[model samples]
Target: MQKLSPVPYGSLIFAPMEGITDEAFRKTILKLYPEWDYLATDFLRVPSAGKYPLKHLVTHFGKELSDVGWVKDKTMFQILTSHRSFTVEMVKDVAQLGYPWMDINLGCPSNTVTKNGGGSSLLLDLNTLRSLIKNIRENFPGRLTAKIRTGFHDTSGFKDSIRLLNDEGIEMITVHGRTRDMMYKVPAEWNYIEEAVKISQVPIVGNGDIWCSADVDRMLKETGCHAVMVARGALKFPWMAQTYKRGFREETSHERLQKIKEFFQEYRTQLESESISLRGLLKQSKSVSRYMLDGVENGEAIRRKLLLSQTPPDFFDILKSL
Candidate 1:
C-alpha cells in the first residue's frame, strides 16, 4: 500500500490551525526553526454547493506548493468537507498538484463546521465517515490520513473509530484526546491515544494539550504514539520542534523573550509582503503574541498593553520594553 513519505519515530508535527497557520506564519516558523518533521495546512473547506476550482486550491496552498521544495516535502495538504462528491474531485485536483499526502479534518469542534456536517460532526456518523474516506482513498493516488477527536459526545466509539480508519486503508491517524464536546476546557485523555496505538494498524499521532517539551516526552512515553502533533502549543513556542530535536534543554527567560522579538519581526515582514493593512497586521500580531507570551514574566499585562496598541510600531515598542 502507498504511504505518506515516511516520518521518523517520535516526529514533531506543527498542527494546522485555522486563520493562524497561513502562509506568512508557516514561512516564519520554518525560517526560524527548521526541525519540524511535518507541517499541515489549515483545512481547505470544499464548498458543498459548487465545484472547487484548481485555481482556488492553488491559492489556498500558496507558496507551500508553488515554491520551496523542502516546505512542500514537509507539509501535508489538509481538507475538511463531508460532501463526498466534492471531496473526490478535490482530492484528484490535489494529487495532480503533486501533494504526496492528504489529511482529513475530523477534529474541528467549531459550531459553524459541525452545523454543516463537517469536521468533528462526522464522528457522530460513522457510516458517512467511512464512505467519505473510502471515496477519497479510491480517487487520490497518494497517501491518505485523518485527524479525529475521540468521539462526538463521548469516547465510546474511540477504538472502533481507529479500527474503521485502519480498515479503510488510512495510512496514519492523529488522535486528539478529547470528545468534540470537551473542547479544550479539560485535560486531554492520553489513555485513549495509547489505546489507539494498540489497535491501529498504522501510525497513531498523539495530539492535544502538549504545551511544552516535557509534555511531548510524557505523551510519547505514555501513549506510545508514533509522533505528537502540536497545535496551540506550537504557537506558544515556535521553536519547540527545534528545542525537542536539540535534546530538550530549557531556554532561559531572556532567551525566550529575544526569540519572541525575532519571531514577531519575521512574522511582520511576511505579513507585510502579503499586503495586509496596518489594522490587519496588528490583529494577526496580537493573535500570535497572546500565546507566545504566556511563559514570559508579566506576560498578561504585556498582552493587555499590546492589545490596546493602535499600530504595529506601538505593539513592537511595548514588546521591546519587555
Candidate 2:
C-alpha cells in the first residue's frame, strides 16, 4: 500500500497495451529497470445495457490483480466503456474489488470498439460523455480518470468534452494528441494537446510517440504537459524509462543490444524459476526479442527462428548465433 513519489507533472508511465503489458511483462520491466513511475493495465471490457452483473469488472481479483497487490498503489485499472450507467456500475465493482483508482478509456480507435458507441466514438456524443463522468462522480467513491484522444475524426469536437470532464471533478486526464481517425499512423499533435491543457481544470497527462528522454523533454517543452505515457516506443525499447531518468545520451548500437540481451537473459531465468510452461513463456520471449535485437544485422531472421521454436533452448540457440 505504499504510494509512488510525488507526480505533480507525474512521470513516465507505461500505457496499457493488450497482449503486451500484462503482469509478467510489467514485473520484468520493473525488475530490470525501476525508473518507470506508473502503469495502466490493459482495459477490462464492460458489458452494456446492464445485461451482465457488475461483478464482471472484478474479474481481475485473485488472478492478475493479486500480482499487483505488492504494488497496487502505483497501478490504475483501465476500463473500456462509454455508458454512464455501465461506467458507474463498473466503478462500484472495481472499488469493491479493492482497486483504489480507475481510468476510463476513450481513445481506442479500433473499428469494432468505435462502432459500439465506446472508445473514441464517445467524443461524437458529448452528452453521454458528460453524463458518464457526472454520474461516476456522484456515485463512485474512489478516484476516477479519463483517457481520451483529440477526437474521432476532427479534434475540434473534443474541447468541450475535455472541459466537461474537468468540470465533473475527474481526478486526471490523459490526452493522446491525435484524432481517432489518425490512429497511430501519424505523429501526435503536441500543439493540440497544449490547447487541452489551456482549457482543462484537472491535471492533464500527454501521451503518444515519446521514444526517449529527449522526447520526454520535447513533450514537456512543446506542450507544457504535466507528464507523458509511453506506448509503442516503450515496447521497442524497455530501457526507455531509465534512459529518460539518466538524461538522453545516445547509446551505441552495439552497447544497446548487449544491455538488452543481458536483461532478456534475466527475464528468461525468472520465467523458468517460476515453473511457467515453456510454450507460454516462449510466446512472450518472441515479442520481447525484437527489442533485444536493436543493433544486430538481419535481426528479423533471428526473430523468425525464435518464432518457430517451441522451447527456450531453441530460442536461445538463435539468439546465441546473433
Candidate 3:
C-alpha cells in the first residue's frame, strides 16, 4: 500500500467537518484544486469502556481514505473521545499502521458529541484534556495536532489551553474562535484568534467565517495565524481553495454551476462504489446538493427538485438540468 504525504502549510486548509468532510469530498475537492494545505478527517468516535472493538471504530481509517488514491498523506485521522486510555490506545493502533499523524478533535460542538463529554465539553474539564494530550503525546511518537474552540463557554481558559498544548508538544493547533454557546452565530471572533496567535508557541490555524479568498487574506493579516481552515465556507463555495490559489479569480454563474454539476457526479461515483443503502445514498445526495446550491439564484428550486428525486435517474436528470 502506498502512503500519501501531507500538503505543506502554504496558506489555506480544509477544516474537519463531520458528515461533510468524507473521503469523496476531499478526493473530489483535491482533484479540482490541489492547493489545499491539509485536511483533517471527520472525527473518529473512539471505542469507550472496551464496549466496541478497535476494528469497528477505525472502520474508515486506512481503507476509506487510502482507497481514495491521492489523499493518503494529505489527510490526518481525527479522534474524538473523553477517555484517556482509549485515546492513547486509538493513537497507538493507528501509529502502528504507519499513519504519520494523529489529530485530537477537541472543538466539535455537536450535541451528540458534547453530551457524551467528547467535543468542546472537554474544554470545560481542562485537567482531563491535559491528561489526554499528555498521554497521546507519550504514546504516539509521530506528529500530534489538536483542534479547539476559544473556550467551552467563554474563552476564560483560552491562554491556559494554549499553554497546555505547547507544553505537551502539540505540533499544530486549529482554533475556531467560538465557544459552545456561540454555535457559529454571526461574526467569528478573529480578535480572539489574533490573541491566540500572540500567546501560542506552535503555529495556530485560524478557523471560522472565512467565506472567500479575501477573508483568507484578512484572517492571515489580522490574526497572524499560520494557516486558515474553512468549514462552512468550503461548502458555501467549493471553489474557494482554487480561487485563493488563483488570486481570487471571479467565476461566472455558468462556470460555477458547471463545477457544482461536476461535484454531483464525483460524489455519486463515490457513493455508488461504497457499500451503502439506497436510502442512505439519497440522504447524502440531498445533503450534498444543498451544500452545492450555496449562492446560486435557483438554488432552492434546484434543491427542491433534488429532494423530489426518487431514483438515480431522477438525480442524474437534475444534475443534467444544472
Q: Which one is best on lDDT?
A: 1
Which tens-of-lDDT digit does each residue in 1-322 have in candidate 3?
A: 2323333555677888777777666767776667776776788887775534555544555356654534556677888888533666777777766566778888888898888888898889889888888888888866788899888889899889888899988988889989878987857898888988898988888998988778998898999998889988788777788888878775777887888887778877777777668787787777766666766778788878888999767877888887
Give the Cα error of residue 78 in candidate 1, in Å. Answer: 1.0
Model 2 agreement with the true structure over 101-192: per-residue lDDT tens digits: 67888888999888888888989898888887777677666667889999999977878888888888787889998899999889888888
Q: Candidate 1, residues 3-119: lDDT per residue as tens digits?
A: 446778999999999888888888887888888888888999987866677878776777544466666667888999985437777888888877777899999999999999999
**Order of quality (TM-score):** 1, 3, 2
Overall lDDT per candidate, in order of appearance: 0.87, 0.75, 0.78
The lDDT of model 1 is 0.87
TM-score of 3: 0.91
After superposing candidate 1 on the true structure, give the runs of residues whose Cα lies further than 4 Å from its correct spot: 1-4
Comparing candidate 2 with candidate 3, which one achieves the higher lDDT?
3
RMSD of each: 1.7, 3.1, 2.6
